[model samples]
Target: MSTAVATRSGARRIRLDVRLLVLALVMAGAVGYLMYTGLQGTAASYFVTVSELQARASEVDGRRVRVGGDVVTGSIVRGGPGEPIHFRIGDGTSELEVVYSGVLPDIFAEGRHVIVEGLYRNGQPVQADSVLTQCPSRFEAAPTASSS
Candidate 1:
């Protein structure tokens, strides 16, 4: 009888150990999946200038990116009250056409520096999701008169 009791206890211990091991594996897998998804969500979008985008056109086509350039003078065309606006952006030697269907910022205008976030369509124009304009003098301090 004593030998029988010892055998049963050993069996129970083995079962408990197996259960614990399975639980640990499941928890580890869950943690790994969470980490992978977090990293994917936090991936940074590519940022480039108009000229750089032109140089890498083949590589960046159809990918979401942020391009910075000056709005070309005489290129802004506003549609009716609720229509999309079309414009051209340029970086000195290169240029890109952009189409955005959103309300224009009060500061958005021709010749202003702007950053456009969107997908570049091959052989077409940039399908802009958002447009951002920089303040002309946000970091500049007021000029001070020199006291001789």
Candidate 2:
């Protein structure tokens, strides 16, 4: 009877050890999968200037892109009341023509800082889904007609 009880206890210990090992393996796999998916989802390119984008257009085409530059003066054409915006963005040396079919920001005007998010296809600027405009401060008073 004593020998039989000892054998049963040893078998229970082995079963418990196997269960713990399997549980640990499952937890590790879950953690690894979460990490891999998180990294994949957050992997994205960043904003760049028009000149840099032009140089890397071959490599960046057909992928998600963000281009930032100053809006070229005299290049803004407002179509209709709420139609697509057409403008040119430049980085001192070169300019990129851009067409964005979304509502422009309130501060989106000629000579403003703009960041366009879209893809460049076949060396042409594709329309972007989003546009960001950063306007310069105008707190200082300019000489108005009354003052002048």
What is the Å distance of residue 141 in model 2 from its true position?
15
Q: State model 1's lDDT.
A: 0.90
Question: In model 2, where is the ten-residue run with the lowest total lDDT?
Answer: 40-49
For this target, which candidate reaches the highest lDDT against the unseen true structure? 1
lDDT by residue (36-65, candidate 1, tens digit) is 998887774446899899888899888987
Off by over 4 Å in 2: 61-63, 133-148
Q: How well does candidate 1 score on lDDT at residue 10?
A: 97
RMSD to the hidden true structure, all candidates? 3.8, 4.7
Summed over model 1, clashes come to: 0
lDDT of each: 0.90, 0.85
Best by TM-score: 1
9-57, model 2: which lDDT tens digit per residue?
Answer: 9999999999999999999999999999988767743578888887887
* Cα-based lDDT at residue 133, candidate 1: 89
